[model samples]
Target: MHSPTKRHALPKSNVPAVQPTPATTTDLTGFTPADSSLRGLVGGTPVLRVSQPFTSPDRGFWAKLEGFNPGGIKDRPGLHMVERARARGDLLPGAPIVESTSGTLGLGLALAGMVHGHPVTLVTDPGLEPSMTRLLTAYGATVDMVPAPHPTGGWQQARRDRVTELLARQPGAWCPDQYGNPDNVAAYTPLALELAAQLGHIDVLVCSVGTGGHSAGVSRVLRQLYPGMRLVGVDTVGSTIFGQPARTRLMRGLGSSIYPRNVAYEHFSEVHWIAPAESVWACRQLASSHYATGGWSVGAVALVAGWLARTLPRDTRIAAIFPDGPQRYLETVYNDEYCAEHGLLGVRPGPEPELIGRPDEKEVTRWTRCTEIADPLAPTVRTESIEGGRAR
Candidate 1:
């Protein structure tokens, strides 16, 4: 493996910038867009044009189809992180890069490794998507499973510990540390620009806030483009996102046990606390009724986007970032029996009621350090259900 010097991406500016489409005065058949540019991946993927008025009403409602990527939305950050590091002379041509991911980042890393001729090692827990494991392996990267769930163990902590172990063993281990790594958010800035070009103008942006990487990174840029842009950050009801006790749930990729420095909550104009059941139901709703397939995070995001669609102005361009594709969740989220076994069954099938749209101001909702769950900074957070009926 090549031993490249450690390099960091530049700090992201909150200033708004719009992404401009390729302006061509003449058409040339058999001409392809320029290669070697990340922006090329931005809008070429499928974007659904919503016809129905948001059950409530946003300025306008649409979803960016990030699942079209070879992996998923996280790939945007995954590729950028590795490439930027290499450009800055941080990653040697064949250096073995290490990272902790739920699954999405691993996909992105694999792509990066193949393109740059590098080796990628992923530190993940057993709680990951079954298909995700296969996808990473198919991409030709090494998948190292962390400690199983213990009496008080967690997958997040376990993965982080593996990263620490790898760093201690490997001479030049570079952990993206998505939680604190600014590049995680910085890599997503282009998404905001793409949406601006796609929607013409955005009045409200709906997305789930986990490590705050996607929301913070994208919202900062979107808010800058449209100063009046209303950014809605969605969190699960039992999530520690707003600095509360961690709640066990089925949704993945959104909400965190600790306050990630990369997430910029200040960029959000509003926040919605959706329950796990709601997210599961939303995922089903998207697939069964809307004819669109999405995973847990996308479903959680759609729950908020659906609500915002019905409440905000009709012309307001509402774009929600849909992370991974549904192919990875066939045995879990896509399984009705699996969902019924989980607490996610509680979310009913009735029409979505008129939500106040305003968040609970009296509620304690601020990003803060987590003690209720394991240390987020630590390499892993072993997962266990309070219901203990079956363990992962």
Candidate 2:
């Protein structure tokens, strides 16, 4: 992987600064604009204020409900990337869209394929849920399972390798490498705009880091409006995205074994690495206490957001991005036996993580607030293995 230094995207402030129109709602007549078009329904998801289960009303935050989209948060990028490519003539009509994904992006690509009159082939791994596999096929995406992990890089790399093979075999195949694509970062502009209109002003933005699309895209736009707003990044313990060594990670949809090109490390003010058990606990708390919840990344982001809401001043208005709903996690995160089997039920986040240096710095590990941000892969940086949650 190339050092993050090789590619640095300058932040642009030219995106729309419009006030948010009131969120549309469907009346009993059921003729709302959202019902008028499937594409319109992809966005315009609600940003609901959350208070309970974790934080008091005064300390509560708002949640951007991305599950309202048919395919989850990645749907924004899936369509944007495909449309952008088509406009540039990069994606010829009927070209096959092939890319590697875990699940969310697979659904997004499948949706894109459906709307743009093209076939999509998603390369994933054995860890993909049967439910998601069926969902992708239902959306007309051909699923290719990479049979094994790569010798050095694990399932993610293996899946990428398979995508390469498929792309080579298929003519005019376009791979919207979400990890490296600028469009993925650009796709969340409307989301940030929506939050801006809804909140009027935001003090903080909390998001999980997957391909780093939503966080990077949303924060960049929000920062233009609320320059003082803090951007908090959430990640799984084993992810190298924040300079941690690659270890077996239980949670998906956030964090990465590979340092993705899309992560805007400099944009983040601070980052949190949450354990699977901690996320499991948070997820259950949301489900039981508030009847609002999501998968691993959702729980992890909520945990941090809840903490921020509780600790920040009462006047602080925080917004946490919930990637998708809990439907995908029912077999794992929401399952008591699975939680107990994995020793996740009663577990909590690890001891307060050490804050080290600026996110771009190489020496940063565990956690650290630094003055100057540096390359995450700097030679001076040494990565320590972060263990997964032990079975209780």
Candidate 3:
């Protein structure tokens, strides 16, 4: 077992920690004749300073609270992709918009559809939260759940296959191929600008890698402003994005079974793979301490960011992105029964991650970090070894 000294460090914040608050609806702004739609509420999210349990009070990171948006971080891409497609005459007015999403993007698409006057269809897997399913449906989106994982590519590919079939049946329908679409990466420019404006100077950026859109997009813009800024990518343990073999993943909104073309492999200085149990611990810690937390991606990202804060210089300014709020995770991450059933309860992660020289050095099964980054799709001497058995 790993040492727990650093992991159990006490909080240094002067303010007392508060319990997480339940969700509520305080806004009921009328959409009068002179008022515009809700598209204006997509950006301008707040940033929270995360300290204490995650990191020492003197060493904390800034978390971009994307949950403040109408949907989540993907709302920027979902709306931008559709808007760009419409401008290029690719998505005609009143046409159907079909795409594959885990959950967050589905909400964004539903919002985009209502804003732009299009019918949206989302293909997802059975692992999606029931609350998320109901919310997407309530937002006027047709949820198509894939029954099983693909033989090789997993649920992501299965959803893509279903989307292909849906597109074949509907004419003039547009599917925002977020995995390969450049618009998804471009959509995060505004977010990067907001971060630069909010923090003045960012020394390091930490992001969760799912479709690889936000990480690549945000880093691209931020690097232009702060050329020396380092980018750290956080992914789930079973994710194939960083060259590990694809396996069944419990966490969503981060990690991928297949390599997404949007991943800016060269931009990442290092990558960390977090386990589901570790994420659960971090999520609960954030809730009880900071009273502000998110789901899988958020938890995983926070874990990595907290480590960076403890190890890096005190002057280092690290910014981590929290994709969505914890409301959708009530049935899973926050549910005691569900966590116990999954063997995630009472499991605390070590302070430091196991370090590796390369991503394909060995099949990582727990919290691991790699400094040498390479594209799994690119040709290399180790590619043969990875294909032979290392990745399996």
Top candidate on TM-score is 3
* lDDT for each residue of candidate 3 in 1-392, tens digit (9 for 90 to 100): 87666656786998988989999976668645433558888889999999989887788999999999888899999999999999999999999999999999998899999999999999999999999999999999999999999999999999999999999999999999999999999999999999999999998899999999999999999999998888889999889998999999999999999999999987888889999999999999999998889899899999999999998888989999999989999999999999999999999999899988778789987899887778899874221121121221
Model 2 lDDT on a 0 to 1 scale: 0.81
Better of 1 and 3 by lDDT: 3
Best prediction by lDDT: 3
- What is the number of backbone collisions in each predicted candidate, taken in the order shown? 32, 9, 0
How would you order the candidates by TM-score, starting with the best?
3, 2, 1
For residues 321-378, could you state the per-residue lDDT of candidate 2 as single tens digits?
9999999888889888878898888776543455544444443323232323233665
| TM-scores for every predicted model | 0.77, 0.83, 0.88
Ten-residue stretch with the least lDDT total in model 3: 383-392
Alpha-carbon lDDT, every model:
0.69, 0.81, 0.91
2 or 3, greater by lDDT: 3
Give the runs in model 1 whose Cα sits over 4 Å from its true position: 1-43, 51-60, 149-153, 349-392
RMSD of every prediction: 18.2, 18.2, 14.0
